[model samples]
Target: MASRALRAVVAVSTLLAAFTPASAQEAVVNVYTFRQPDLIKPALDAFTTETGIRTEVLFVDKGLEDRIAAEGENSPADVIVTVDIARLSAAKAKGVTQALEDETVNSNIPASYRDPENHWFGLTKRARVFYAYNARVPEKVMSYAALSDPRWKGRLCSRSGQHEHNLALFSAAILHWGEQRTEEWLRGIKANLSAAPSGMERDQVKAIAEGRCDLAIGNADQVGFMQTNARSPEQQEWAKAIHIVFPLFENGATHVNIAGAALARYAPHRDNAVKLIQFLSSPRGQQIMAEQNFEYPVEPRLKASTVVQSFGPLTADALLMDEIENTRQLASEIVGRIGYDNGPER
Candidate 1:
């Protein structure tokens, strides 16, 4: 009986010891992210390594806003991270996110890329640029208007017309060139396709390399990914055949978008979440975002990736991102109306 009592006392003592440190070191941040693990893990590791803050991350591709809204004030999520302006804005409008007053984020991100209401801040920039076969497509055809030329007929390739990147570009054309002109532009480009819409940006580039098409519409980041570490000889050959072109002023420069973050409305670790937001928007964080991820830093002083630099300077479209927030519906209608599903003519 004495031995059994002694054993019980030791178990209690061990449990108390474990609980003490956990209670004392209770500062932890839980982040919900839509970004791919490989792209954002480096920054997450760097933040934890430098700050001694414990972090837990969950990656989900969709329905984050709905989940958080359902959780109401009981949600354990501290920060919500995602790419693209539309997703970020939608989260804010849904009231599952809260505004931040972090000086670092506000001062670092340009007004053009961030929410005017301070609910979210952009971490990186991505521009809609064209990838073309250097041997076939002339670099002078950089503007969206130029794509309408008859010379480009039966010589273009791209992802689904319903994709967000293309939708943003089409909306940019509508903003600058008018609805009639935009629709005409869409029809002209559709006429030029060498194949029915594929589902990926990389495939569009591949089509260009294979001589199935002369030009492809995509973001510049994919070009960098291809040039750096080609998984195969075919990809390397494709890389060799392609050159990037930033569209012109009449398209209103390259329409740049962002990957951004907002505080969860029910953030359990409210203070830690704010700290993380500040950290991500600071110079150190921005530099890591640029150098490691090949994204344009929100901070003005940090240089773009060398691959991005090769494309030369861009004058991004001046239209507000919010203006075309409903482009998904519009794009679906436009693409369907023009019969993009049908492959090019024989």
Candidate 2:
């Protein structure tokens, strides 16, 4: 099983030396994060050791931006870390975040991964991938364009087309295929739904394991989570039932979305906040993130942990995340306009 799982990830490469801590008064940085505290503890610990600055964290699953806004200018939050461009953009739109002007952060992260306006910076990337029932599906590779084929009608499963994951996926479609063709793809997927798109990607995988469908769509990191799931052993069976394939756009690039961070607008410890963010993009911080969460690091030279590399090689798209993000609203509208969640028209 270790050998099998080992092959799932493709080792990305290692990182350079850790960065020198920035100059700052010994102070505390208050954090508001949507990610679990334990997931980021290693990097946070390293930050303290390097900078002599303590970190106080507040963890929440959602509404991070809204909560910061509710706290107003006096909000203690210095940094806000969360997943998805939707949330990151929402924080910027709500004026809960401020533009970060730091050369360390700018140099560590490429322009493609950060907001053009510098409101947020990406720390990691994850792929939207396809899962096939190993015994029933012989194909090892898939293209997103092929999902619309009639051969897959009633044999495919996915979460709602409007979910942020799918919306991001479709938004890429808009970039690669244009609106008319992307609309056609959505309609075709709707026509092919095994049942009305419902539940999460896990549910779609569960259905595949049960033989309700032969193919499913889901995030690659999710499979990593399911494989290592100790609390719910049944998830292991779901992971075992399928092999993941990185789906490519028409231009031959896989789609990836970011998990990034922004500075709180009223950050009381502005200098400390900049240090934490820069450290996060540093080789050491990126290494901690890659190993801890099993995600691809935003740093160009860092590789994913052995466990994550097992998922497969990810050839992320040339399209800037901001480009994909720009089209998400249109993607959502298309999902709504076509009644994507209502299932194939009878």
- Listed in order, each prediction's TM-score against the native is 0.86, 0.90
Per-residue lDDT tens digits of candidate 1, residues 1-346? Answer: 9999999989966743442224323667878888876777777778888888777776778888887787577666788989777788879989988888777677777777778778888888777888889898767546778777889888888788877777777776776776787788888887878778886877777888878888878887777777776456666677788888887746446777778889998777788788888888877777676556556776556788777788777666656666655554676677778876675556
Task: Give the best candidate by lDDT.
Answer: 2
Error of 2 at 112 (Å): 0.7
lDDT for every model?
0.76, 0.85
What does the lDDT come to for candidate 1? 0.76
Candidate 1, TM-score vs. the true structure?
0.86
What's each prediction's clash count?
1, 6
What's model 2's overall lDDT?
0.85
TM-score of 2: 0.90
Q: Which stretches of candidate 1 lie over 4 Å from their true place?
A: 1-25, 230-233, 326-328, 343-346
